[model samples]
Target: MITDPQGTVLALFLIFCRIGGCVMAMPGFSSARIPMQIRLFMAAALSLAILPVLWDTVYPTVHTSSATYIGFIFSELLIGLMYGMLARLYTLGLQFAASIIGMMIGYSQPGAADIFEDAPESSLSGFITFAGMMILFMMDFHHIVFRALVDSYTAMPFGGVMQMRATLISFTDTLSSTTYIMLRLCSPFLIYGLMFNVAIGFINKLAPQMPVYFISAPYLLLGGLFLFYFSVAALVSQFGQSFASVFIGR
Candidate 1:
C-alpha cells in the first residue's frame, strides 16, 4: 500500500504549497495573533485531507523534472494567494467602512486593540469589524472558501499556466464590488454626518458667542451612536449576506 512513497510525499507537498499560500493570506487564519506553527499544521492537514480527492490531478504533475516542479510550486502558491486575497480584500473593505463609520459618527476616539488582528483601530471600528467577522464565522465562510478551493482544480487544473491578466482583473473586480457594498452599508451615517454638520454650522453662525462647537459635540456623538445602534444589525446582516455573491460570483 505504501508503494511510491516518494511520489506520494511529493504530491502532498505540492498540495501543501497551494493551501499554505492560502492560509498565509486568509483573514482569520492569517491573523498575526495566530502562531506560525499552528498555521503550518492547518495547511498540512488540509493538504493531506485534499490529496486523495485531487490525487489523479496532483500525482501526475509531481513526476515532472525538478525545474518544472519548481515552477509548479510557484504557480500553485500564486493561485492560492489570489484566492485567499479575494476574501481578505473583502474583509479589509469592511474594516475601511468601519473606520469611515467611526469618523463620520464622532466616534473617532483613540485607537484600541483589534479583537481579531493585532492592528489598532478606533473602538467603534474595532467593534464593527469584530461583529462582521463573527457573522462570517457563524455562517461558515471558511467552508465556502474551502469549497471554492476544491472547485478551483476544475477551473484551473494542476500545472496550467497562471493567467496574470485574469488574476489582476479578479482583484480589481473584488475591490470595486467591495467598495460599492461598503459605501452602501455606511451611506446612512454619511448622510447623517453631513446634515448634522450643516445644521451645526448654521447654529454656530447664529450663536457665535455661545461656543456652538462645544455644545454640538455631545449631540453629534449621541445621535451617531443612536443611529448606529438601530442600524448595526441590518448593516452586518447585509454584509454577511453579500459575501457569497461577491466571492463566488467572480
Candidate 2:
C-alpha cells in the first residue's frame, strides 16, 4: 500500500491545485477580510476529503511523463479558475449594481471600509453589497458551487483537452446573464431617480429664483431610503433565486 507514496502525494497535490484555485477566487473565501492561511488550509482539507471519492479516476492519470503531468496540473488549475470566476463574476454583479443604486438614489458619496477594494462606493452601496453577500452565504451558494465542482470531473475529465468553444459560450452567457440581473435589480431606482429629477427640473424652470436643487435633495434621499427599507428583502431573495438557477440548475 505504501509502495507508491510519492505517486499518492502527487495525485493529492494535483487535486489540491484544482480546489485551491477555486478557493483562491471564490467570494468570502477570497475576500481580503479572510486570512490567506485559512483559505489554504480549507483548500487542502477539502482536497483530501475529495481525494478518496476521486481516487480511482485521479490516481492512474498522474502516472505520466513529467511534462504531461505539469500540463495536467495547469489544466486542472485553469478549470478550477473558470468555475470560480463563474461564481465570482455573478456575485460581483451585485456590487456593480450597488454603485448604480447609490448614484440613482442620490447617495453618491463614498464611505470608509476595513477591507481594501479598487472601486470606491457609497455608504448605501457598501451596505447593500455586504448584505447581499451575507444573504448569498446564508443561502448556501458555496455549497452549490462545490457540489458542481465535484461533478465537473464527470462532465470534464482530467488529462483531457479543454473544450474552448463550450467554455467560452458558458463564460459569455454568464456575463450577459449577470448584467441583465444587475440592471433588473436596479431598474426601480433608475426610474424613481429619473422621474424625481424631471419633476425637480420642471419646478426649477417654473420658479427661476427657487433653490429647487437644494430643496429636493432631502426628499430624494428620504424617498430612496424608504424604498430601500421596504424592498430590500425582495431584492435579496430574488438575487438568491436567480443565482441558484445560474450555477446549480442544469
lDDT (10s digit) by residue, model 2, range 79-134? 88888888988888988888788887888575666232545566777777778888
Give RMSD (Å) of candidate 1 vs. truth: 1.0
Highest-scoring model, TM-score: 1
TM-scores for every predicted model: 0.97, 0.94
Model 1: ten consecutive residues of lowest lDDT: 108-117
Q: Name model 1 segments beyond 4 Å from true.
A: none
Q: What tens digits encode model 1's per-residue C-alpha lDDT throughout 68-186?
A: 99999999999889899999999999999998888888886988888778778888888888899899999999889888988888888889998898889989999999999999999
All candidates: CA RMSD in angstroms? 1.0, 1.7
Error of 1 at 33 (Å): 1.3
Model 2: residue 180 alpha-carbon error in angstroms:
1.5
Winner by lDDT:
1
- Backbone clashes for every candidate come to 0, 0
Candidate 1 residue pairs that clash: none
lDDT of 2 at 43: 96
